[model samples]
Target: TVLTPRVTLQVVLSRQYGSEGRFTFTSHTPGEHQICLHSNSTRMALFAGGKLRVHLDIQVGEHTNNYPEIAAKDKLTELQLRARQLLDQVEQIQKEQNYQRYREERFRMTSESTNQRVLWWSIAQTIILILTGIWQMRHLKSFFEAKKLV
Candidate 1:
């Protein structure tokens, strides 16, 4: 089911044996979104005739393609096949570009967080070093005075 900013769909699929289906969800919003699917049996009996299997595939946007076989069986010409292939490639490239942008954004945020942590660590180390130096100097002065060395 698709729940776009302007439209929403509440899909209800009946659970039955040997049933397979696919659904597409298109969103105008250009960000990551969750796509979910649930499958359940409605049979009341402990067991049904033989075994039941349901396969559900959910595809979003341009990732949905079930036409290559059809095109091949129809004996499409080389030029026609090339065009279809190019179209598919374009769609795939767009999807990949979006995914790359998402990853880059995530990586940038992580880099910022790591930089802040490193800055704090450096400050802590400097404070510790200064405190240690001061303590050592005071201890050495007290020892020299106790021994009347100056």
Candidate 2:
């Protein structure tokens, strides 16, 4: 089965799939994706305790494209198609690398923001604690003074 973030592209349900499965999905969203599978939930399989194994071979970005098909489609000679494929692959690698860097930057920004919030929270808590302690001590002192015990 293949899925994009907003929709399910393909699903093979119930019927037995082989040990190996190949699927390609092009992601327009730069975030995370999920590839999920589960055993049949039918009464028979559940009662029998059936087990399943799935092997996935996933290729992303430009590697997902069949260069031979592209070449044939474009009617390019061997050398030109090979060069085109290499250039395309390199371009894809650069895109993936940039995506990783973007994620890291976003994570770093979030972490810094969280750290700032925590620091401010800690400061506020400490100030409240100190003020409460002072207020309590003053109240205690007044009570003792009125009773002439201090």
Candidate 3:
């Protein structure tokens, strides 16, 4: 295994102390990608200390598509290749239901513009709390009519 400009992928069959090996390759360049493995067995009874049990399963998107191994190498006729794999799984479930209806219409227009900006900020905090309770009731009724007590 050696991807990128080094290029060597699919020659897998070596691991055998209980035997398990699988190989598949497809990547044409996107960013940060690399893989390298080597054990061409210099043999002291197969590398003197044998123990490699790797169960790496990396499946990225749309169900790791193999398309029935390309409809069994294009001979096609198992019911016309299962009706072309049911029309490519109904066009990948109609592009995942149109990307979940475009993410539920962009999360319902961002929850109706955050409930209309919290209803205009609760009507501007109830008109500044009723004009600060009518300016503190005309400043305690002009300080109780200038101290005449009423």
Candidate 4:
């Protein structure tokens, strides 16, 4: 089972297979994802001391595409296949750029929010200091006048 960054569960292999398996999935959203593997064996007592070993080979971006398969499936000539590869590369670059833009926008919004909060806090502190000074001066003036030391 694979859990996407959005927390959506996708079952790569519902049934138990051999020790080795290959699975692939396309991610529509850009974020961190989780992969989980567990044995669903009915006969747990068969091998109580047996250990399960998993080897994962994850590929992303341009490497994820099986170029030979694409070429054969599309019936593309050598030139056509090369052009298709270039196009795929360009498309991947565009997607990466869009993701970078999204991250930049989020960072900008966070920075602006923090700056606004700091500004407001400084203004509040200034106002409090001014009020305190005024109160102290008035109290001292009354004390001096009462003691005939004005």
Tell me the tens digit of each residue's lDDT in model 4 across 56-119. 8888888898889998898889999899889989999999999899999989999999999999
Point out where model 4 deviates above 4 Å: 6-20, 37-52
- Model 1, range 1-150, lDDT digits (tens) per residue? 333332334332323323465444445565544444444556654265546554656565445655667577978887887788778888878977997898899899999999999999999999999999999999999999999997
- Top-scoring candidate (lDDT): 4
TM-score between model 4 and native: 0.75
Model 1, residue 110: what's the lDDT? 100
What are the clash counts of all predictions, listed in order? 0, 0, 0, 0
Better of 1 and 3 by lDDT: 3
Model 2, residue 47: C-alpha shift (Å): 3.5
Candidate 3 local lDDT, 43-94, one digit each (tens):
5754666665467677744467777787779877789877877776787687
Q: Output the better candidate (1/4) by TM-score.
A: 4
lDDT of 2 by residue, 1-150 (tens): 434444544342223344454544566666556666665445586457766556677767776778889888999999999899889989988998999899899899999999999999999999999999999999999999999999
Error of 4 at 105 (Å): 1.2
Tell how far residue 111 is off in model 2, in angstroms: 1.9
- List candidate 3 segments past 4 Å from native: 1-63, 68-70, 73-86, 93-95, 131-133, 147-150
Ranking by TM-score: 4, 2, 1, 3
Better of 2 and 4 by lDDT: 4
Specify the poorest-scoring 10-residue window by lDDT in model 2.
8-17
Best-matching candidate per TM-score: 4
- How far off is residue 144 in model 4, in Å? 2.9
